[model samples]
Target chain A: MILENNFDLKRMASQVRRDIVRMVYECQSGHPGGSLGCTDYLVALYFKIMKHDPSFNMDGIGEDLFFLSNGHISPVFYSVLAHSGYYDKSELKTFRKLNSRLQGHPTTHEHLPGIRIASGSLGQGMSVAIGAALAKKMNKDQSLVFSLHGDGELQEGQNWEAAMFAPFNKVDNLISTIDVNGQQIDGPTDKVLGLLDLHEKFSAFGWDVMHADGNDMDGIVAALEEAKTRTGKGKPVMILMKTEMGKGVDYMEGSHKWHGTAPNEQQLVQALNQLEETYGDY
Target chain B: MKKYTYTESKDTRSGFGAGLLEAGRKNKEVVALCADLVGSLKMADFIKEFPDRFIQVGIAEANMICMAAGLTIGGKIPFTGTFANFSTGRVYDQIRQSVAYSNKNVKICASHAGLTLGEDGATHQILEDIGLMKMLPGMTVINPCDYNQTKAATIAIAEFEGPVYLRFGRPVVPVFTSPDQKFEIGKAWMVNEGADVSIFATGHMVWQAILAGEKLAEEGIDAEIINIHTIKPLDEKAVLKSAKKTGCVVTCEEHNRYGGLGESIAQLLSTNTPTPMEFVAVNDTFGESGTPEQLMKKYGLDSSNIVDAVKKVMKRK
Candidate 1:
């Protein structure tokens, strides 16, 4: 819970972005675009905000819970979790390989810490996050629940169903963040479908809505702080985080094509050069 | 010894509600989550009594299912409440990935199952839930017969830690079982002990099996009735033992004949203890709006149907 508003979150996000690109390049089959874009949010949450011991314990009781709704972007989540000590940092090379805990999507079966639910098909993670938050409330623990979803994943009706249910049910202990990256697998999200007025939409759905620059660590830190302060007030909170499709990677940035595809070796090297090897490449 | 009898009938969903409330009191880790069907799933009492332990997840069954899976990682036992259809079919992938495959200990409490859901039509009635859930690797499937049994199954599965599919129904039926009868998962309940033919049944079908047993007994054909509550682990021992003794089997359920208890029984009998088998279940078809009894009769799921299937299987034997 001791999150420094500083530590150059942008630089940390840059390192996480490099991890996303390099890890995907090693795996040769992972989502890098959304992972790169969402690096700041994940980094800010795990490295700064979250109070978790990443020894990767199976029973994550008395600890904060995080669910990945748009789990295709496992690259960023894996990087953040690994960097924060959920597993051997060297395990990043095993991503998407057979028998790796870091699968192409998030799953708890592998006994990985920080991931409580297996999510690949979009729009289910928030409900599970609310479930854990409800469990925390029942356990009389004040730990919060955090989750992230893609802008395109909001098109799935389940998100709105969770949207309507959370506030009305007083799931105020959950803090859900949406990666409003405006780009998805096929193309730019507007071309795919306009995720129109996401802020007002969640507001109408009975959530206390906030907006922040997802790629800006300061904004993420500040918004997350506000999200925590808003809990226990009888309403769920959602942060509409606007971020770029491939934030730190120069070539992959703003490309929907990189959503599920991995960066090649040359591209990985270029991405790494742009980002300092802060924790050293896994 | 005195036998328990039913003076009245009640919906199995209420039994689930009672079980949920009891589990809430007994286990501090027990939590309930509903997908907007508070009244239909009958999770209102648990929600009211343990307001902090209850979660209203709106109509997001997929989300509700996955969330229940997550709650288990925190050592909290989550029982998900929803219609049989939405609980299984709508969110099969979610349950498969999170709860079943991940091996999370989430109790999937489904009500208003099969044709007995009535008036709401086929959309609400789920005839294939047993099949869908049984396919999962570590899933424990149970379809309780009556109020006491359903309530007992609910409380029992909470003690045995794992993923469970607890199926019950909407309509009021027989409440013959003892109020405090302890439920044993994957164990068949022998309601009658005759040698003519074995009637293996579950859910609301248990009452019909009892009625059919009486009718068969009246006709000089002795009948044996067994309640196959826990469908997945398939009480193979009980089923095979009874089938071996009887030499003929008739499987009855309010679900589809394809993946319901019958198929499992048929498979077990063919490989392990092959016996002539007949199924009194819904043939691959949909349900419609009608009284539950009317639907039971029309869809060939009533007591008479069980009698006919038994006689038919007996002739084959």
Candidate 2:
């Protein structure tokens, strides 16, 4: 609710992209590909779409819930959360450091605002999203639950379990999106474990599936709007976002190698040049 | 000898169902979720009274655990229902991350615990649940003795914030705990007091310990019976005081000997005040399909086991 009218989601995206690099570089380890890929969409969700308070309450109380199912990309999730006023942006430098609130995987025990559950183990956030949606239904609150997952994480049997559950149980208050970067740690998702056709799979599971260019802020915003319309229909909505491994930065773009390996001093400088300090470095 | 009047024996899960309905009425935030085990977990009352508040997740315990964790974020105290096997070992990672590590105030209500689950066999019975839940850093594990205590504990956890694991049994057991006794989380309740040996028991074993103490008294053995309901953040003061005075101890539970209440008591005594102790529990084995009484005896978890363990430990004293 503290979101300002002057808030430019694109500016937020740029700053987030910068922090994504800074954190990965500082930690010398993190998933930059998916983090870079989801920057614009995460920006749209936090800066534009969702309503939350930055005073950092774990129990969001009357506020919308955002869950990160694929927790390895803590760099991007951390950047967006820090940017949105959950914590001092300067705290971003401490990502993955000992005793830091921002661990390798995001944890609510740290009492960070906007994050409800810890979901480093993928395929869980969807169910967690449904549960939160169910809570909203119980409380009679109209707030929606949002969750993001990696495309590779779909291979987890629990994802299909949740996919089957949300639709069948009428968990319609949730909007779940997948980070379809098509790349994971081992190799291309097809090589590691072929996802085959994600759309048909989700469609068969009864989710209202929508595809979007995740890097384009406008497309993400529009798709989210379309997703919102699909809500209250007694069926959960899934957005399959097509994105480059490294979307904005040219050197790291389109490769799974950047998925977890962080940029060194020179590489970080090169990456940061592509991302302007719109909101300043976190 | 006076003959006791025939009343009724009910599964503790039914008590949970009754308690859920009452808790929903008392607290506006208490919402219940079940992964297709509503009838089995005895959550029908809550589901019937508050349909909007009850969620039927359809045989997905992993999803159920994570979702319950998420619900806590919006200031909702979610009580997730499933069998003890599904609730603990099946979804340990989900609970570890979402509920335990994140410290979400979700109540993991596990029904049909231990060999008492019966007939369904080892696949259903969960002897390791107490150990599994207690190992978590910030978890409060409670194994209520009977129907009334199970119901009371269900209502009790709603008010006490933080993560809780409420374990209950499936079989129809004697409901003898005080109907009006308040459910306190970590304080052990002194059921009866004697001096020869201290009998610290939990879950269905509480009633068994009482029976064993009564039998031991007739044989000129003085026994102190204590109900250690809350397993984690254990009532160390009560345990040590009784063990130190009696100079001997016997721990009983329908759980594994490795990480169950026996191990906890052993640790307490070995570290602070060492005392002779014997364990009356399953000895590194799984249970088979049988009646509740049969499994208890086969697994050596009956009151006779407690009685024998007490005598053995007292010999060391």
Candidate 3:
């Protein structure tokens, strides 16, 4: 399902943004900030960039795999997974419900089709992606593995442990990206805790580092394609994707307040008006 | 009472390594990962044979655990090797989320368990690993008694799906269990049958319980000895049947008395049978630098301690 045209990709991204805000606003108990921030990148990855299967299997052999390390932004993940045809888009309404598969964090416990690991405690997804990449290399499968992480989540020490592991082992089959939104739940990441020069840090740890604009649909698709070309080299690739805290909505944009807070009904109507509903809403 | 003896003593970790190698030979999906303790974990053989299948994470237990979980996503059975302390406490969140909660088929093989880790002192010795691992939902906890049982368990868990915690020790204990014995996941092995008192033992303490049984036979106590290898899905049927027949119970282990084999049994019996019982374990304290024998004696986990506990428990009965 590779959408090579930029128009189609942007349209899907608009619909995904609609799903993200509606799902969060309907529940009033989800993170809309990071989810909106990472929407274009996920939409591009699932629809255009990555070679994946929507009819998912646990053993995703010979296909590209994506792991959501920073699982708090599950609204975008669930929306993207649904729009990508992994499950019913109507299941999006069940987000954070009692028996719903869409947990507060992305988990494989409920047999969710796309989610392969349970995450939310923070800083565990990289290791899991590396392990899956290692398994791919062992099975002689040439397919690549992709993972996304939050920039604030790098404060955890376990991420550093994985940061050292992937490149040292020449895990060239993995391309991990960090959502550099610079905002956490409390405040800005720089104020909460400084993550000084992630590009230099990851490069020092021996990864081929790249940077891209996460909000731009065309740039994200191009960066992902370029990242694919960089695979099978000596080192694993890291993309420092710079995105806004709240990307689409007007009042939420560039603010840390909406990182986890959902919009009110009037605000949701305003947000929906701001972004045209490209496809029918779930 | 049945007689039990061994001509040689071997560390249970060696059995794990042997079993891992055999499992790797049997199934190519069985991969091994270590946290810079390959020599200590006795994983040299597995690494030597299947270098491509082995991952040396260089002292990152958390990464190793999560990576093991990730490997399962692509249909690989990963066996993570490290000391019990690092295996459980240090990376508990990683195991709880990625492996246990995610239901990944990762075998967490831990060596140097309990006070028997000896001269490594309190920091390295982890007496609460069994409790920590067993508490996780969908985690199968197995503390094998000896070399053969550990090896059998290592191979057996590779076939069984989902998460498992296999705990062994650093000390060279008796290899009394048969080399040909098939390891059942939650089944208890009846070591000896008697009527006075039932002694349930796990890990290194099973051998000590056998010695206690011999001593009790001389005193006409006729202690029933049962080896409880799997601590999580405990064989409640075997435990209650033995308790009903023997009327009294004693539990032996080389772990802390607070949350180890003894507590599991006590919780079971207190609910179901409510039989009088005594525990021979480390009394909720840290272990210091000493020989394995000296630590066992000082911590009241020796065969003599089991004998004393049996006698005292019988009095309560």
Candidate 4:
């Protein structure tokens, strides 16, 4: 899929950040800090890197597939999926509401367009991604499988289980990215539990590890493209992306307090003013 | 009561192995994953026949369950093979989130259920798996009675389009059920017909119930026997029909009485048609290291227990 220059990827990232704050404010619930932090990475993946279809099909047989392990950041995922034409952007209004396809966490139960699995429980996406990659190999489909996970969620033992299985099984058609914002729900990840050398840890687990600045669209796109090249070479790839807790909103930045709490109306206005309205609000 | 005779005895896990091979031949989409218990799970034939479709997930049951959920995404029918304890309780959160709640078409084929696992002690012998699996929404729970029925169920669940938990046993028992009998998901098979009492049994308890029926017959008391293969969907029509005829019920299973077949029958009867009932199951206790026969006898899961339950339930009516 060729990148459409006319549709500026950076501009789309700003719009997605705006959507994240507004949706969280409207619902009076949801995680805005992580959502805003991960906006640029998701925007780059959907708009620039991934060769997926906006004509949503659950079984992404011939298309690139993605799973969200840290599903609390549903705002950015919902926004990118909508703005990319997976669904109507107007449906963003139903986020976290009863009878809404946009659930608090990503789920396939409601027949949501882009989501393939329910992943709020954490540390399950990489394993699921590996399974899909294995299926793609069986079917001789060269499409790659991608997944995003939280730095804190890596504390879950299941991720390490998957991390071990992927390289051992030679699952080369998978690319997993970790949002290394250094903050979790409780506090900063280092204060909570230090993940001293993430790259070395992944390297020890037999994965091709790379580093990226998640807040920068150029760096995010470049790292994702580099990860793709490393595939089909007898190992799985991992990109440790460094980002801020809240990249756009001023007050919410650099703290774990806004990890789950929604911004109030006045705060939402302040956040929106900071993020240029490249696209109109839902 | 009618007598049942079998030329040989085989473990239900072997039946699963045979059925897996057949299912693989029938559909190219059938895939198997094992958590480092291939020989115990009896999946060698499948792995040998279709090497590419088989995945060795090692000792990680959580990863195995989640990966099975993922394989279903690209239209692969994934059957995860492991011990019952590891299959259900050990990785329940993964099954709940990725498989049950997402409604993935993954078959959890669990062997070594109940006391019949033998000598592995209370830790490996999971008596509460039925309750754990049955409580999950969109999960089909099936505990086949014998080898033929287990083999049939293994193939049958592949055709069903939702999460399924197929529970079987490790000990070699009578292959009394037919080799050619068709397996239906929520349908009950009437073993013997009588008016005195109705005996509903599943898994290893079916043979015990049959034996109990024969003993009751010689004593001039006729007993009706029904083999309940599928536990979740419960075959309400057949259960209610038998309960209405006999006016009393004796539910038997190789599981805990609190959340097993007996409790499900009680809930069904109390709501639609209240009836006198007795339970022939492990009374909320764990099993210890012993032979299958010794454990069954000690835990009151033998034919004598069923006969006692039948007589007790008859008096209440």
Residue-by-residue lDDT tens digits, candidate 3, A1-282? 567798998988888889989999988898999999999999889988788998998899989999999999999999889988899999999999899999989998899899889989999999999999999999899999999999999999999999999999999999999999999888999999999899999999999999999999889888988999999998999999999977989899988999889889999999999887886789
Q: How many residue pairs clash in each candidate?
A: 2, 0, 0, 0
Model 3 clash pairs are: none
The list of candidate 1 runs beyond 4 A from truth reads A1-14, A56-61, A232-234, B1-6, B35-48, B57-60
Candidate 2 chain A: 10-residue stretch with minimal lDDT: A1-10
State which candidate has the highest DockQ: 3
| Model 3 misplaced stretches (Cα beyond 4 Å) | none
**Residues A31-110, model 2: lDDT tens digits:** 88888899888888888788777775655557777888998888888888877777778988888898888878887776
Cα deviation of B123 in candidate 3 (Å)? 0.1
Per-candidate TM-score against the hidden true structure: 0.92, 0.95, 0.99, 0.99
Q: Taking the tens digit of each residue's C-alpha lDDT, what string does model 3 give over B100-205?
A: 9999999999999999999989999998898899889999999999999999999999999989999999989899999999999999999998999999999999
lDDT of 4 by residue, B118-191 (tens): 99899999999999999998899999988999999999998888999999999999999999989999999999
Poorest 10 consecutive residues of model 4 chain B by lDDT?
B1-10
Every model's DockQ, to 2 decimals? 0.54, 0.71, 0.90, 0.84
Clashes by residue pair, model 4: none
Candidate 4 structure, TM-score to reference: 0.99
All candidates in order of DockQ, best leading: 3, 4, 2, 1
The best-first sequence of candidates by lDDT reads 3, 4, 2, 1
